[model samples]
Target: MLDRKTFAEININNYIHNINFIKNKTKTEVIPVLKADAYGHGATQLAKVVENIGIKLIAVAFLGEGINIKKNGVNIETLVFNYATPKSIKENIDGYIYTIGSLEQLTELINFFGKNIKKIKFHLNINTGMNRMGIDIYNLDKIISLIKEYNINIHGAYSHFATADNLDDFIKEQYNNFISAIKYIEDSNINIPVKHICNSAASLFFPEYSLDYVRPGIATYGMQPSDIKIEKELKPVLTWKSTVARVGLLKKGESVSYGRTYFAKETIPTATIPVGYADGYFRQLSNKGYVLIQGKRCNIIGRVCMDQFVVETTQLNNVKLGEEVILIGKQKDNIISAENLASLAGTINYDITSKITKRVPRIYIEEE
Candidate 1:
């Protein structure tokens, strides 16, 4: 029984299924991206799950995230994707595999570690065409020179795909650039054992680029990365739910919520759910969203409040307090997915799930 009025249910089985699917598809090392708290599915918990499943490596966006995984007794290799600062490198030397994208960042690591720089290992981020935080292909010579000069240990090399999901011509361009960069490093006598550049989209849509390691972020959470659908099987791992808080009647012409945007055209029964924008339920869903109640879709009646929102419950056979209300999940024959919310909110699926605030507790379950 759930004590919290609003919470997210995480199906561990579904998560594992997604991971296994990606692994089987790629036929290579699968590095699950746990950044943004595993796309708001709870990183620490999922990291432990990954470790238990025999996966050797996981990736995060910050030093603190990687450190948190280490602190939780998860021994999997936590690779920090962001560039490391002097303080971060010194504070937790062994907790993370830092990503060195620029010559200056690499220089900082060498300066901080000094003669012991060889003891530290990092992945080189090559900027093919994203022009994001990475060592430009033109500057790879300088980066390679510095690594040789200090005898720095290079554990891996990687790049990001800006258009892998779109299947554009530029993906080939970036792939070719990454290939040339790796060859240049090897020709200079630097051995980077692990090489990867495919994200969730590329991992699914362009498996050839999976390389030695595939970093899947959104796909691991069982959400489609884009509109380009694939034949692979992926199930949603999270179900955001709430309970009917109050049942009441709104007279004709009665307004609901703060903005008074919804005025009832006819007298109708209404149910208020204990969820709102404060709980990561977007206010943009006001008057446009629907929730599953008693196996039926109930239209949101007005502007979503800070802690509660009204939904027209006339479609239900009967409405009662404390009844199950699904914000994102299957309810009987109907379902409310994050992608559904994202579409109604004028955003992508990533924004919908990742923005779910920390106020709501996550309950992990292993469904058969």
Candidate 2:
């Protein structure tokens, strides 16, 4: 008996199902990424739901996120993928894992924790090809030296691919770089605890990239790089819905909404919904979006303003005030997937979930 609002409904069971799908896919282990607040589905709630589902590690993008989850009282090994401040690193080491990408950063960790550090877990990130984080491949020896000099526990050896999510020549080069770095590390006998490089796309489609454990982000929340076929069912955890605040009839040649972006050539009916870009519905969807209503798909009739938008429903009958509008989930006869929204905005699915504004209320639901 959870009372969900009209803005966002989180299907927790679907989220859990998606995680179990990935977990079973690996005969080995799975590290689910709960970063970006569980892809903006509320990290604390998601963590609690999946805590007992055999996830050995939970990862976040920043120090604050890790801390936030810690505050939630879930006791899984938390990893902050991005670099943290000295203060934040100490906090991460206090109860979670932090990433070590460079000797300079390693020195910062040592200075912050002092010799009091003991059995602190961290990943050694290799720049491989992304050149975004991690030590460069050429600095392998330096990184190894720092690993011991600082008494830092090597939890994992990780890297990021420049194009793992897309089909490109660069992926091959990045793969070579990743393999070379791993070989180099093994040759040095460092033997870091875990080895991983797969993002959601690579984990799902590129089996070759799955190493010790996959660091999957989007797919854990039922989203992949783009729309790709998967044998395992991935359930989308979040669904957006808002009530129709008002209903109206527009005569022929009547323009709807703020910018007059849509005009009706024939008399039609329109409904105003109290959701827009301010709620992370994406203003780009204005005059260009469709929502499922009464088991039928309806078009947006005007520009998506900050707090509201209009939908044309003349073709459909029996529409009324206070009816539910499906914005990001399957309705009776339609579906608006994260991939579907991302395609319209020329963005990634990750951005689509992360962009959801906090103003909207999130309600959690599980299988009855």
Predictions: Cα RMSD each? 1.3, 2.3
lDDT (tens digit, per residue) of candidate 2 on 224-329: 6545455347778888887777888889998988878788999988888888788788888887788888878888878999888899997778788888889888
How many pairs collide in each candidate, listed in order? Answer: 0, 1
lDDT of 1 by residue, 94-203 (tens): 74688898988877777777878787778989999999789987878888888888888899999999988787889999999999989989999999999999999899
Clash pairs, model 1 backbone: none
lDDT score at residue 203, model 2, on the 0-100 scale: 72
Best by lDDT: 1
TM-score of each: 0.97, 0.93
Model 2 bad stretches (over 4 Å):
1-5, 111-114, 117-119, 227-232
